[model samples]
Target chain A: MKQRTEERMDQDLAFLLRYENIAWYEDGVVKILDRRIYPIRVEHVICKTYAEVAEAIRQMVTQSEGPYIAAAMGMVLAVQEVKDRTKETILAQSDEAAYALSHARPTTSRQMQAVVNDARQVIRDALAEGCFGQALVEAVHAYALHYLNEKYQRYTRIGQRMEELLPQRATILTQCFPGTIVGTMLRACRQKGKEVILYCAETRPYFQGARLTASVACDMGADVTVISDNMPAYVLMNKDVDVFLSASDVITRDGHVINKIGTFQIALAARYSNVPYYVTGTPDPQHRDTSQIVIEERDPRLVTESMGQKITMEGVKGYYPAFDITPPEFVSGVVTEKGVLSPYELDRYFDE
Target chain B: MKQRTEERMDQDLAFLLRYENIAWYEDGVVKILDRRIYPIRVEHVICKTYAEVAEAIRQMVTQSEGPYIAAAMGMVLAVQEVKDRTKETILAQSDEAAYALSHARPTTSRQMQAVVNDARQVIRDALAEGCFGQALVEAVHAYALHYLNEKYQRYTRIGQRMEELLPQRATILTQCFPGTIVGTMLRACRQKGKEVILYCAETRPYFQGARLTASVACDMGADVTVISDNMPAYVLMNKDVDVFLSASDVITRDGHVINKIGTFQIALAARYSNVPYYVTGTPDPQHRDTSQIVIEERDPRLVTESMGQKITMEGVKGYYPAFDITPPEFVSGVVTEKGVLSPYELDRYFDE
Candidate 1:
């Protein structure tokens, strides 16, 4: 019965919201939908080896939650590489692949690492029960698929919670791509006859908000408009923005939200403007606060140039810090699969 | 003696800061150094007629104070166009040219209009003094040149005031191109042997901060770094930004500042971080406050594409408001030719 409900929800998602479009594994190949040039070009980067998948993540072919999903599938590729070998060899190789995948991007890596580690433990348990060879490969593949399914279901529940929390009619200001949760929330809103207007900040250096978030919102049939990264404060001041909603790459147990580089500024503006800022994601039990968070500084070339074309002068220097930490004070609430909880009340998310 | 001092000051400016390089009138043609593709290519868009000059300003071939200077020279072209006609026809044609140049871009148009109108009055005065034809053309040209000299001298004084206001060694955060004032300030800082670090927000859509501001600062031999527009708030939080300084397109008598779209957000962040935010410009005696300011919505194509390459997907809508208003409460002070005055004390700027 639960499977039937999830299948029905799957049909309601936009093209990009579908798990297969974000990433998929088929016949010894892990295919990741290249989000860097997505919507403009629907192409995928094919990876036959785990290292290739890790490189794709480093190159940002897939971003946000796509990395986490792709990393899990990468572990499957690791097992498939040595499927004919001993169970001990497969286990050792898969652990190495998991380490490589976890370190792909610093800010979002911890969760991906945890997912891969859990899969490794599952393999260890299955091996003790006599699972080996092709059966071992099948076991890892099934584990990865199951993990992907659980992620989708969790996001769907969070989206439903978001739908309930959002007003019947709302104008939301969001920064960067928030993964499939936005599309799922839009779908949920449609079912309940709620109206949502989205203003996406065109995340600079990489136009994720423009190409990914806005495209997904458009696919979900929401009234969406893309604004440059700097326009959010102006929009909040002039436009009727009901809420400032974004996805948190990491939500610390003590309630800080680490997200894309521009999120902190928007949160400041929202707080000053009397608008509540809510971040969507499950809390990280490992991190007690923001001290453990590493703000990744990507290649400066990404800022100085766009699509291999120089936007500024040749000699000029550019700084590109990929993520920023938003303190708990600025974040009004965290929308998790459990429900909408005050930033201070995030401990409830981990109670189970 | 005054002319010699002005000439010596002229030598200290960056290549882009020189008046002739900004916009020059020679042999009946007004040539404007195109800032849109400047630093990358030192090219000028030649304008043979007043209409062509006005069109260039509208097209943003020249921006900020470039249009004001170009508009003044544009009036010279207007007078040159009617050099063979009667004095009455010359005066009438110049008036029409003044009106067209004044309305080139909304926020900056009022000043451009005022400069052209002042040139028109000079033409009328010259005609009354029995000047005609070629003599009339020379009179308008002389007036425009004198106006240009006065502007440079005023900005130099303002730059000195800024140098006095800034700390001995400081890191300043600025947004967009603030015309020649930034170059003048850098020169003054060098003279005083004060160390300075500049973080420029690469104002999106046009990239004026990256292409124009950073280039000028580099020429002036200052330590400069270009950051994406979204990164300013993050920098303010993490980096030691001693001051937030920017150029205001319009400063009303009530002390509100209207500048490039991203300025307001930076001001908010600076204020939240407990840093003073200062804007440089003379106050408009004609207007009372932000109510009279016109924030321009530029072409969406400029936002969706960078250097003719599509940054976002097709069929996506982009919002591009060229400027935003910063309330008096957020502005630390207004740096004018007279001195650095509190936003509330802007009335002193018009005491003359």
Candidate 2:
């Protein structure tokens, strides 16, 4: 029944390119949907090498889960490039590819590192076992498939978990785009006969919420309203915001949940208004505390302009920190593969 | 000594069109510097009637103190329309002009109302004194002069008070650009040997902070860093933000201070980080409580695009409440003509 609902949700939301094959490695080439002009334009960045794939991630051709999935595919392409080489040389190239892809976006560097590195580990183990050429490339394909599978698994559980947290009818206040988490969650909720009203923040300097999240939510037929990031406090003050849910780039063992730039402000407003704020993700076991998490400062061109059109006064430099950290106490819960975990319960995520 | 520094700032920051005469009633036409294309293209809107002037204000051809000052100039234009008529008809036309201009920007409606109505009151007094014809037009001119002088006086006090608030070198966090207050304040601070590093929020949907505030600030020879409105919490988290100051649209008698949409979020972020939050303005005596203040819901087109370019996905709706109310408790102090007044001490303003 749940599987049928999921399939139907995808059908309804087909207008959004997010659910399509946005990133993949095929025939020794890496291709990604250029999300910079998403919905209005469907242009893809075709990459042939690891460096090209790295540049795609850096340029935000595909961001959030797209990068996570793309990096894994990038490793597969790296294997394809060195498929003619010896096992030792393939291992070296795979390691280099993994390192480059992970550092593409700094805030999610560690989490991304885990994805590419885990896939690289598989290639290394196969090489160590004397695997080479086409056999090693097949092993690389396995790693890409594994990464994609893990991502889907998390999405499956998270959407189901969130649907349970809500009643038959729910009003969700979410920040940034947070990519497809809210969209999938709302779609899954609808599958369960739950109605959702999503209030999204049109995350500034990027417009991710308006461009990305709203596309998926609206296309999926959920009731969605996009607001400027500034309006969160106003909505929380006067409206009935049932839950504040957003995706975390990285959540430390200490419960420092980092996401988009405005998430901290939204969480703070939620706390003040007595609204329950949530983050959808498992914690990163590597980062012991908040200090280990590096917040991303993007180029000023992004904040000072929109779609290459200069918006602000020229020569007025802008600081665009792409992400912010929300201290654990401010979070009501962290929706994970298991269930709604308390911020402190993030430590248990590593147990698996 | 203070006068010398002010003159120097005007000379240094002359590159920005903001410091020029932006609005004036010239030869029976209300000519306003078109703000939508500010700092990039210099253009003016020529309004020959009250409706045209009101539409200019509605389209944000002039904003902040520009509308406040321009609305007064608009009334003078209304008087020009009926210059050949009796005092009673001119007075009636002026009231109609005042009402039209006040509703142009709702969040600042009362504040704008006060500017136009105060000028109308001057016209009423002139009529009561048995003044008419050229004499009434002369009285209308006096009203415009009185308004310009009052705005300048408030600016002098605000800048002077802000000058006292800072140390020799301080990093100040500001929001929505808040107009020439920061420009004049930084100028006065420089005169007092206080070098300030201003971190401005590029208030989204309108880009006022970036286009208006930062233009004046950078031109004035002050070191300015423009950050997005999404960034206050991040800036306050690690940066040495000595103060968070913004201008209020209205400060109620009960102390609810309304300003740009993101002010409350910034204030909350400031409070969380223990940074002193201050608003530069005197309270409105007409609004007895928070209930009296009206929050504005602006057109979504402003948020969906910038500089005539569509930045977000098509078909995605946007909510832009041009202003947000910062409760008195969130405000640390109100920098006024007298001194830095406590938020609760606004009642003393009414007493005077």
Candidate 3:
């Protein structure tokens, strides 16, 4: 690769192409991408107070790493609110701020909780040093910058591994958007002068593929094509698909992958069609099996409507489970920051 | 049965419910239900001439039996248009009228072409017998009524056979709205004091399941739930699914079933789960295999948008194959007017 990972991160990262100003500090406002209406319209949720940041998380203005960034930004906004107050009040309010921000999306990602806890610890250290003036705000901002930077480096590792594994001019079928995980991978392929064609299934209810994946891939110089969720099997059955790669929300020790609702079905079809299907991301180390993982059943209205528009008959009931489990038997590999790990070698792959 | 097939056909055969007035004769106009904007909006395409009827067919304003009925009504309307003209002109225009109607949806169903051909023959005999006035119009009307009656009877036989096979209170997962084939079957099941719960996937681009099937099922006294196209595999994997019955657009001699794009995937999941998957309706006697059957590649805009709203990123292409082929191994039964035939018993089913 022409640009090394350290060189890329030091100057201008590839994330600037689309998400440059999506999450940033402006005056006293911590702005985040309002992902609810993404791809259709580019808008941001401006958080003046920590509560607004929490509400944005609860309302799902952004998801995955977006939540972690938003939560860290919330802490930055938290210290700004109590600058005029006493030192005791500032210390008391900061803990409350952490609780409010982290609890907004409690089950989001372990990284999000770690970022929140780290930010709180940074605040505690600043207060302990008896420098509650400018040192405190600078410390929180430094931690936020480091948190996102570390996350990007992890993404770079995953992308490099994906670039090494994915074939040139590959037809990759993917489900929901996995933040910058797929975008970085496509960019990495672009750096090697490889043309990566992505077939993105428009994940229903949330439409993560349509609103996020396709948009991100297109902006990153990849040829992105959107297909309805039902069209994946047909494409796999007809086209000369090189691989089926998706980002997993959770990967158990037994290699059971769980992500968006349609991932399992795509994996099933890929298994039957003899297509190589891989889940590329970091797996939750604590999760041992599918039964322990809690699958969220979303409100039925999300499925019956789109972009806040009702598309079904008045009396029709909708069944909407946000995610489904794809047992290890259907999965071929798990491409992670460490390396490309097979389903059977998941335990050993993480152990090292 | 509480309602005899002939008795119901003479009056209201329950095609109403949601698809009411889709095809009907009103004064001098042949009004066809504009199925494109169905359930959400009830509108009709008034066919005043043969060309308008052909255009309606091209626009997909009606499908399956709706097109057959619409075509017959268009013929009756065509006869009315030229009844006051000279006999020579009347006979010439009638032949052209039949050509226009039949070619409107050639690959739709063989029954449609046969009905159009039958009406044309009736017109030819009427003109040869030296009848040129009210007798000719009555003859055309008789052919239309007879065409609808026979089609309904075929539907009745298929519905009855389906009723015999489907378990009571069965949880059925269905793909695209299989026109009145599924609605009629559910009605027959309902009539026999059986309760069937349906999981209807809202077929993308064209919401046949959400806008047509689930609406009709609910109005016909069956419990129906609408799901996004991606939910079918999850439903089959988790739910106590009794059967997977989809309407076939074209069922080949070797038992290859081609229906809506999502049907093949559902069949795959069903086969893997050991759920009985059936393709209801008459098999096309002409097509010998899947390769012979032409799959329509629909406009990509239909996939990028939903119910007239754009849902994809700009510059993102969408691949929308309107129909997909499911091999014989995925199918367990093909319910027809003859009987509930096995995939391998297709030739024998037609032979009898």
Candidate maximizing DockQ: 3
The candidates' DockQ values read 0.70, 0.61, 0.77
Q: Model 1: per-residue lDDT, tens digit, B1-352?
A: 1343445346688888887787789877888998998887899999999999999999999887888889889999998998889877887898899999999888777777789989989988988999888888888888877888888888889888889888899798889998888988998899999998989898887889988998888887888889988899999988889999999888999988989998989999999889899889988987787777778999987887776777665567778999998899999889988888888987877776
Best by TM-score: 1
Q: Which residues of candidate 2, in runs, are more than 4 Å off? A: A1-20, A125-135, B1-20, B124-135
- Fnat values, candidates in order: 0.64, 0.63, 0.79
Question: Residue by residue across B1-352, what tens digits does model 3's lDDT show?
Answer: 1223334442323344232365666577778877778767878888787779878987788875677788887788788888978977887887788788877654554546776788888888888897777778878877776667676677778888888987777888888877667766876886888889989998887787887888777777677888898888889988899999898878888888878888988888898788999888766777777666667776799888887888877788988888888888898999898988877768876674
- State model 2's lDDT: 0.78
- iRMSD, per candidate, in listed order: 1.4, 1.6, 1.0
Measured against the true structure, the TM-scores of the candidates, in listed sequence, are: 0.97, 0.93, 0.92
Error of 3 at B147 (Å): 1.6
Question: How well does candidate 1 score on lDDT at residue B208?
Answer: 91
CAPRI-style class, candidate 1:
medium
* Predictions in order: lDDT: 0.86, 0.78, 0.78
TM-score of the first chain in candidate 1 relative to the native first chain:
0.96
Q: How well does candidate 3 score on lDDT at residue B248?
A: 83
> What ranking emerges by lDDT with the best candidate at the front?
1, 2, 3
